[model samples]
Target chain A: MLIGFVWLSLTKAGVPLDFSFLKDFSKRLGDGFWLTVALSLASLACSLLIGVACAAGQSAKILPLRYLCNIYVGLIRGTPLIMQIYLFFYIVGTAWGIENRFAAGVIILSVFEGAYITEIIRGSLLSIEAAQIEAAKAVGFTGRQTVRYVVLPQMVARTLPALTGQFASIIKDSSLLSIIAVTELTQTIREISATNFRLFECYFTLGVLYLCLTLPISFVSKWLERRYDYGN
Target chain B: MEIEFRSLSKQFEDHKDVLLPMDFAGDVHALAVIGPSGGGKSTLLRILGGLIAPTAGQVWIGGEKVCYEGAAVEAHRKKIGYVFQLGGLFKHMSAIDNIVTPLIRVHGFSKEQARARADELLGRFGLLTEANKKPAALSGGQQQRVAIARAISAKPKLLLLDEPTSALDPEYTTEVLGIIRELKEERLDFVIVTHEMGFARHACEKVLFLAEGQLLEYGDSDTIFQQPATYKLRSFLGKLLEWNI
Candidate 1:
């Protein structure tokens, strides 16, 4: 009833409940939407790589490497993600003189998501019993080989659900890239609302689009989770 | 075929010496270490498995000094198979996959070959029906079988089991012990740390009684059980005999 009342009030106030702006916004948000997807996909890939590497480093036997990884995780996790994005954007564009907002956006998202992924991966790695490592070692596996083959396969399998959820989070968080004017879906909706004075419609359409993208991811993640649940 | 430990001692910073200085040499195919809890039997097994270093000693596997200070112990571990007290099957893998993991990963067998070998091993262990089942779905005995199958898949010369059947019910324990006994007939060398004196007496060629991390007695099973040489061994046997009876 509350949602209906709100919808009626907005429609009666000439807020334009129709999704006609989607077509117009699609034209303006075209290249930017593709760029956003590209940036998100690229960033997700890089973050996964960084996260796995960091997790491995954290789990490493060497003291310095583990300490460094711990510090990295702590710093990233302690601060707000918005601050991290702003810091990375400013550092990359001004200090590093990287003119491409696309590059800056990708780098920012990758590092931001990488920190969270590292924790998830580390948790997954440590979830494995120490006995498994011993068994692998006993079977002629060097430490490196044991981790690469025995530990990693199990880790990836165990953490796939959490990792995919993290990936979806990265995609949603890509909206923050609009601060630097990367013109992703959120930015496109904002531009459309500003031009057509249809804030409600624009946001609703954007929400639908996000739902479309993320709902499948949620379902796929759930399915993958079931499939990969080897313990069951 | 031979293992020699010279003045082996393991001391943790927090605890007293877990393994007291001990010298032992053996050429037997199957040796069982039996002792009460906190006897450092697992520590001794780990040292033999090359998972840890001894504080002051050397472990020679087949006459090669494998556990010297600052040595790459992993090389020595290549010749041994160590099963933990639990089955320690990889939770994320099916029984077949768990059996073949080390084979494909460490031995570099092709995927097809590894699968076939894993099937053969699991089939031999009566786990073919549960090949696709994960460790969580399998019974404790089944998981232990998978672990043993995985351990022996690499065909190591020496097998080290730390209380392999301690976690199982009597029936499952018997099943696992029967499998180990069968493996022994294949000429696989074994060092089993067990609480089951009956299995030890029947399956092991020799038994080493450990007390407070010290070797109290080392002899053939008949001699160790029937005529313990030391006071500690006598008391340990007395306790076990009372429990069993």
Candidate 2:
């Protein structure tokens, strides 16, 4: 009801709502949508690997390794993703010969998202009560066994929902990669609007398409939280 | 099990001394450590379990000095079981798996052996039907019972309980206390930190009254409850039992 009212009012106010351009651009938009999904999935996998490693490093006994993880998280979180993307792609990426825009975008998104994932994992691990670890020790579990049985299970239960929700953030954040001309959903919309001058229609369709990707992920996140709602 | 604390003290980096210097020794099947909050009862129990190293002195259990360094500490921990106030069962695992996994993984029991042992403990504790439930599905009392069962499943020589029933309602407290009392019949040695005055007096053979990081009174259960040597003990017991039914 609200969306109909808003769309009708905007159309009556001379905001052209011509979605006819979609017929011509439908195939490109579809490809862009799939590209975003693929990018998010690949980054999700990479970020999880990076996040787990960094989280473990943050808790390592070696001071330098712990410091390195702290510094990585601190730097990523302290700066904006846009700035990081620009600097990493233009400066670090070029210097390191990471030339493929798609690969560069994946690397940037993974690094950016990995820091947050690391915090999600570390926070979950920390939330596992000291009593739990102590109980494992009391039962003669080696440090590895304790982590494997007690720490990891509880951590996964605690972090999985948050981590799943983060995929939505990844999909949305991947839109920013359009600035570097990655030809993702947002970039495709930006290109279509530039040619057709249907900025409102194009952006609205973009929002709807992004929601199409994210809403189900949001549902899955909620479902995971309910499924893993163990002894809180 | 026998316990000895020789100038055993624990001071955090902030210099708050949780346990003051103390020297005491007792050999008993059931020893209860009772104290007011922040009185170092839990810390003393942790030291005995080899969970933490005391700052200054030494602990001896079963005639062997408890080592807190390297492989020796792990060895010391292997022979001891501990139950926490929160039950501390792995929340994600079913009750039976909580007991079985540790037996198989840490104690090197074969899967069959671990399953059989877990089943035996679950049956003995009357938790056979709830064996498939996770800790979240169990009651406070049942969770603590599972924790106790898991603690003893590997047949540790000593079990240290840190106020196992403190978080429970009266009914659950009774349920958990009953299980602890039954441990005595099995001849499994245990040191429990408790606020249950009656259990300390009746179920345990020895009592150590601690207050403000000091062992204010130590004696056989009957003697300590009946003839507290210090005013501290007398008043502590009086305040704790003032409104008892």
In the range B1-245, model 1's lDDT, one tens digit per residue, is 78898999999988689999999998968899999899999999888888888888888888878853333676677567878878477676788877676777767789898998888888899889999888889989988998898888878878899998999999999999999999999999999999999888888999988989888888899988888788888887787778564
DockQ of each: 0.49, 0.69
Clashing pairs in 2: none
The TM-score of candidate 2's chain A against the true chain A comes to 0.94
Q: Scoring model 2 with DockQ, what do you get?
A: 0.69
Off by over 4 Å in 1: A1-16, A56-72, A84-92, B13-15, B61-75, B104-117, B185-187, B243-245
TM-score of 1: 0.87
Clashes of each: 0, 0
**A28-83, model 1: which lDDT tens digit per residue?**
66665676678889999999899989988987999999999899889988888789
Deviation (Å) of A150 in candidate 2: 1.7
